[model samples]
Target: MIIGLYFWNLLRNQQSNKTAVDRESKKEMEKLRKLRSIQLTQPLAEKTRPQSMKDIIGQKEGLKALKAALCGPNPQHVLIYGPPGVGKTAAARVVLEQAKQHASSPFLQDAKFVEIDATTARFDERGIADPLIGSVHDPIYQGAGALGVAGVPQPKQGAVTKAHGGVLFIDEIGELHPVQMNKLLKVLEDRKVFLESSYYHEEDTNIPRYIHDIFQNGLPADFRLVGATTRTPDEIPPAIRSRCMEIYFKPLLPDEIAEIAQSAIAKLGMPESPEAVRVVVNYASNGREAVNMIQLAAGLAITEGRDRLRAEDIEWVVNSSQISPRPQKKVPKEQKIGYINGLAVHGPNIGTLLEIEVTSMSAEKPGAGKLTITGAVDEEEMGGGARTLRRKSMARSSVENVCTVLRQIGLNPFHYDIHLNFPGGVPIDGPSAGIAIACAITSSIRRVPVHPRLAMTGEVSIHGRVKPVGGVVAKVEAALQAGVEKVLIPRDNWQEMFAGLQGIEVIPVDTVEEVICHAFPEWAESISERGESEGNWIDPSIEPAVQPILPFMQARSTSE
Candidate 1:
């Protein structure tokens, strides 16, 4: 009976142990289930990054150029120039995948993309370490593993080596060091990276075959390079730029920003108001920023127990983010003498409207028509001194050119002490303001009010010709946003203006004469007659050389 009891006790113990094991297994599985339920959420920008080229916005031509280069049988190095947040990196990655799908493409199915920022890359000029090219780990270094203790040198692969038979995308290529750049150029030329080490002996059989090959035959670095930067061509290295196919990515337009925000909101399955979208576009400069703002607004809305994003939420986020709202330049309600709107492009595609004003008085002495230009670099507190001296000189030259144009139009600039002012004391640097300055001066001299609804941008020549200037599209967009009714652009820039511009009329002017006709239509007949008469009106026999003998003479002349 005791034996039978012992046997039953052993059986019971085994059954109990089996029950415990089952319970432990269940608990472990429950823990795993809980862990699996936890998921890390991705930022809106990353979650919404374009997975395919078709999803990219506002860069159709850029994408086409990239595809042509990547899909060809022989891929060439590419350099992409653009402002930040315009999908330079994303496009590079997607295009590679797209190329792999094409039968004629050089890319293989397993091609990899390695990305790094040139701003963060570090290189040793002593040839000791390089993150881009391969580096040798000497036995004396820490964490050398078994190879270091055994007095064998170890070769470490870098981004260039890992990206072999694929692509290496470097962001902010302009910031790379010159020494590192030269090394990269050498790698590009040879499609391999050579490693050197004092401890590495070719006679050592303990060395791995791969390490031996790298030291002897070099590491395989046959990969295409794609570089992106916010700098212009002049800022990039001539050697590097000369070897690459250049592609320019334009800044995202306001409409494009709105579209990107709308798509992001749709992807999030969140409701958003139209006004909210408009607010986001006004505050955001690019697609990435736009999506970020929407995400923040959506989060705020969720906290408030609301499903739809509101304009107030966006405004709060914008204010909290410290993003300055777009400057609103109010168009004057009434026509005023000597005041005109001049357009200027601040950056890549941001346009600002500057208000220019002019007033003239009788000179203290005959033939002493001094021109004092305010709001340019020459004037203190306008903050343009930071610009290059050449830019400042150009601004002054534009003023002189305007004075010359005035004199050519029968205005006795030598008799009047003309004071030119840019309202708000904002610096005016570009020559594009030449036509506006001339118009302001002419209006002041003729005592005729210029239309407040008119905004003009062009460089006026001494011969009264209006020369074409850059940023016509940006300037016109700024005018339309500022409630300006008409924008006068150079006739040569007619092809450069944006198509389907709404709510504002763009008038193309060929000469300063046409500008005056549009700016002062009421005096167009007199101005036309004076322009035709030319030297006859300015003849010494008919009129005084200095007509402004005093304030009284000026008043009488104006009354006449």
Candidate 2:
């Protein structure tokens, strides 16, 4: 009875152990089944995901290239280049969308696709290469003399091997180092696995070729390589760029920007107005920024329970996002001054040449004509501008001041008018240009042909003293480029002028009186011939340092 009981108890223990093992096994099998179901369902859903070419937006030029590559007889490897978030990657996604459609035919429906980030893949030597080409010693290759124990060597399948019939997308292609790029290029060229056994020597000759032999001929010629980067082609290495068809994606226009904003609103299911859309898009500058800002605004609008997006909402988003240029104060006109044209005389560093056109001329004398002045003047600062305008205005206010000085000098002209302009819309700011602008204006108003080759930059004080300017080198270069023959700079900048400064004569000036004297030599000579002593002659063009009045010009102001 005891022996029978012992046997029965042992059997029961065995039964309990088997039951536990069976339950655990069943649970594991169910877990695997769930995993398998998830794997099967994920790809099916991903395939059915809505993607269409027509709905794609931005990158018109890139789209054309993509169409040509995917639809043409010989598809080329493509590289999309642009600023960050300007749709280089999105353009690639669009291509993949089209490629997916092309691959859906009965013959090609099994085509596979692989997307890899070169930046992440570059760190792993084995990981990167193993994915593209299967490992040399894969299970199928082990313990084979001629072949594996199965008696036949099989080709190891890699991701590239898997992707043989379809496209491989590489994002941020530029981030790939030279070695990775070269490896990728090889893979792109030959779509199959090229395996070589480095760890062990082959023991048999007749195994029908190693599993690595599949990649011997290089990648399958048909596999497509799609690469996208934010860098220009010039920035990319020549070896990699040589294999790519490069395309430039330009910035979106205002209208297209608006469209993107509208699309974002629609995607987010928010009601937005055209004005609000414009406000948002213009604020964001690009599609990616526009979308992000719109998303934030949409969330805010929904959270606040607003039915329609108001301009204030957009403003709030724009302000909160800080996507706009900093606000600049509007300069007050009461504090504003006139801009002096520096085109007449070259100022040291702070001024530019003003070109003058005379429209009207009338004079007290038979040959004289009334003169008005117009042209462009470049200057550096508002303070300098104030002094320059004041000097020019004072010169203009006293017709006698100009006529007496010019006629005594015999540098006379009939009734004249002067019109001035600055080429780059650069506001002339400085007192230095007062004398130069006055000179150019006087030359036009006097109907005298001021030497066109002569260009000058300077600051004129209230009393007509020529003071130094800044940016002498840049001003000189500008003058030289503009084809000016002579650049008259303040004497102070003579040491600073570079030795290589070329193509023009650089003349230095000490005082406004000296420039005027040179401009009106006849007057200077006549005044000298007079027996009047130097003490008796008050130089009309002398600039005084202590003058309190500043000019009425703001040449440096950006907006006219």
Candidate 3:
């Protein structure tokens, strides 16, 4: 009976241990279930990102071109050029989805979008591993799997491999390192990424067929690349740029910013005052910035227990966030002496209305007048005055060119001390501001006022000719936004067609003389007098055949 009881006790112990194991397994699964139930909070920008192409704002033309490329039977690789926070990545993703619906498109239903920022991408130079292309994880690596640990090589798929038959979107592609970029270019040409490693042996008995296949035949990376960069076309490498179709996204206008703000507010199920919306638009330059400002304002309002966003809330948010208002210097209603409005473009799309002002005083010594320029820093030297002057070589050269033209036109630049200033201390880099600087100096020296409503952009030659400048369309748009009534561009830019220039008049002039005629009409009588006596000058507005010059004796006799 004791022997039977011993066996029974052992059986009872085994049963209890089994029951405990079952209970532990159930508890672990319950914990996992609880963890799975937890939800992640998404930012307002991501939550409000457009899922459909039609929902995207402020880039209708770009979207149309993108759609054509993505939805066509033979889709091409693309490069999206634009400023930050302008929906390049989001647009790329949505276009992929839309392409899947088109029967003619090559994209499959399961086509994926694998995105990476080149700014943060890590690459292995030895070809051991690459995050963009597939990498070979050798047996020595810690997580190379049990098979790999047992002296078999393993191939790890990367973004390029995973995005096969779909899109691989690289943000800030211009920031990519040259080595990695070369590897990517190779993949682009071959449509496959080859894996290589000393640890990988084809004849190994333990090697998986898939691993062997990957090592022998490169992994498929036949995916379309959609690269987004904030850089201009010139900044991008020629090889990559040549392979892709480029699309540019313009900077958001004030009205577009306002509309984006309203949409974001509605998505948050929050009410915002119209004035508050306007305030956000005034502070933000792009749709992304506008949405972020609105979200910040909404958060402040929510914390205060206010149901609707107030202008005061926006103001508080702006102050707390340190968001500066858009630089919109009020357009002078009346002409001002020595001050002229000049237009400048920052990048592909951003344009600013710059105010160039000139003031002159009699020099301490006759014929020893000096030209001092401010508001531009020397790029070569980072320190003070002389360096600053050197940094503004373009501006200085422009001033010298203007002086040459003045000397040619019978004005002595050395008779007075000339001080040129670009207000707000903004660096003047390009030659596009040449004509405006000349106009400002002439107005200051001649005691004439330049029309405040007029803004001009063109390069001024030493011969008083106005040379054509790039970004004329952008400059004119900026002038219109700044409430300027008229813009004077080079005659060569007259062929450039610009949309939304209804209220503003854009006059094309080939010479500084023509610009002065339009800008300083009050001095028209003086200009006519000078032109008549100076055989070199001709007023383009008059017929050349009608104005006959008389010989010295004949003219003298007629005057008597």
Candidate 4:
């Protein structure tokens, strides 16, 4: 009876121990659930991630292209090109969700969207670990866990397989490694990913049936690819580009930035003043940047116990961050000789007004004249990894080109030594400066003021033709921001001009004489008042100025 009592006690203790273990596991899981439910503080940018297409700003055309490419029954692989923070990733994410709702879309209800950053996606050389493409794990890493195939190889699916029948998004796809990109192209073509393992024997019965089948018939990777890159189209490999339909997103304008900042403030449950929003717009270059600024400013306002976001808080944030405001090159009202507003593109798409000025004084002796160039680099760039940064400067060559054009138009560059200066010490380089350079020099020579509401960008030929130049859209944007009312682009560019442009007149000029007639409005007006056909394009409006250079002009013209 004593032995029986001892056995009963032992059984009771074992039951108690098992109960304690169950309670411990339950407690741990409850704690885990609680932790999971606890929401951590997220950045304002993350908090405002676009859940719908409407939430994304300044990317209408890009989003439309994305939808058409993915929402159709026959979806195509896509490559999205744009500058950073301009809604490339946001568009990619939101488009897939919307595409799933389309009746004709191929994506099923349970279709997945797998995203990986080519910049961060880990890649291995020996097929040990490739998150982008499928890799295999030899028995050594598995520690021989599978039944019957304890010492055999196991196939591991990567993002490609996981995203099967859906979309695989790769941000910064241009940064993908060469080997992986090749493998990706192969998978894209075959719609399947083949795996290999040196340790596996197909005839071995120990191998899992699934593994054998995977080896025999590759895993299904019949998914669509959606790639986002901050790189230009040319930077991407032709092989990858050929397989995908390309889309471009333009840089965000200041107004769009303001809109985003205001929306972010509203989302943060903060009232925003227009000035405060403007401050954010001035500092923020894109949507992500705008939200980031509003977030910090809102926090600072809360710390100061202000219910509404104030410009002071924004100023504080800007000052604390040491962030420089966008360059405010307001158009100058006063007319001045030897200075003209020339348009030049800076970075990817940001355009700036260049101040090209020329101060001409007759050389100490005739025929000893020289053109001095400054603040312009060699118009050179470096290329590697199939990338090119084109930088061209008409600093010297275009100036020389202008000199030739000037001679043809009856301006004696040799009689007067010209000192052309592109002020602000900013490196100014492009293929050409419009006849604006010639006008500035002519302005200095004739002491006539060029129009205040004008900006121009185009290449000039030696024979006086206004040839086409790139970035006409960006140039016009810069012109508008500077409060300029008119811009002169190459006539050859009329077909490419941006439509729906309000508050600015885009004049397409064919020859230097046309630029002369338009820019020297005084001359144009004088000619118009007299009602003379295109005879002499010289400025008869330069008072007292015509005398100093009239002799040189007549002499040069008569001689030529």
- True-structure RMSD, every candidate: 9.3, 18.5, 6.4, 6.6
Error of 2 at 164 (Å): 1.5
Q: Please write out the lDDT profile of model 2 over residues 384-414, one tens digit for every residue.
A: 4337332343323333343444433334444
Q: In TM-score terms, which candidate is top?
A: 3
Candidate 4 per-residue C-alpha lDDT over 1-560 given as tens digits, one digit per residue, 9 for 90 to 100 = 99999999999999999999999999999999999999978878887888889988888877888889999999999998777888888888788888889998889988998999999987788887899998888877645466425677878899999999889999999999888999999999999999988887878887879889999999999999999887766678999999999987877878888888888888888766898988887887778777777888888878778879888888888889888876767778999998899988665555778888888888888767777777766677668668977655556678888877676556778778888888886877765585788788888988988888888888887667788887677678788988999988888888543555789988888888788888776666655555444635434344435534333223332223
Runs in model 2 deviating more than 4 A are: 1-50, 96-110, 126-159, 199-221, 324-560
lDDT of 3 by residue, 300-322 (tens): 88888887988887888889889
Q: lDDT of each model, Cα atoms only?
A: 0.83, 0.55, 0.81, 0.81
Per-residue alpha-carbon lDDT of candidate 1 for residues 111-220, written as tens digits (9 for 90 to 100): 99999899989987655678888798888888889988888888888899999999999999999998889989999999999989988888998888888888999999
Off by over 4 Å in 3: 1-30, 40-43, 126-128, 201-206, 380-392, 522-560
Report the C-alpha displacement of residue 296, candidate 3, in angstroms: 3.1
Give per-residue lDDT, candidate 4, residue 457. Answer: 82
Structural similarity to truth (TM-score) of each candidate? 0.75, 0.48, 0.84, 0.82
lDDT, candidate 3, equals 0.81
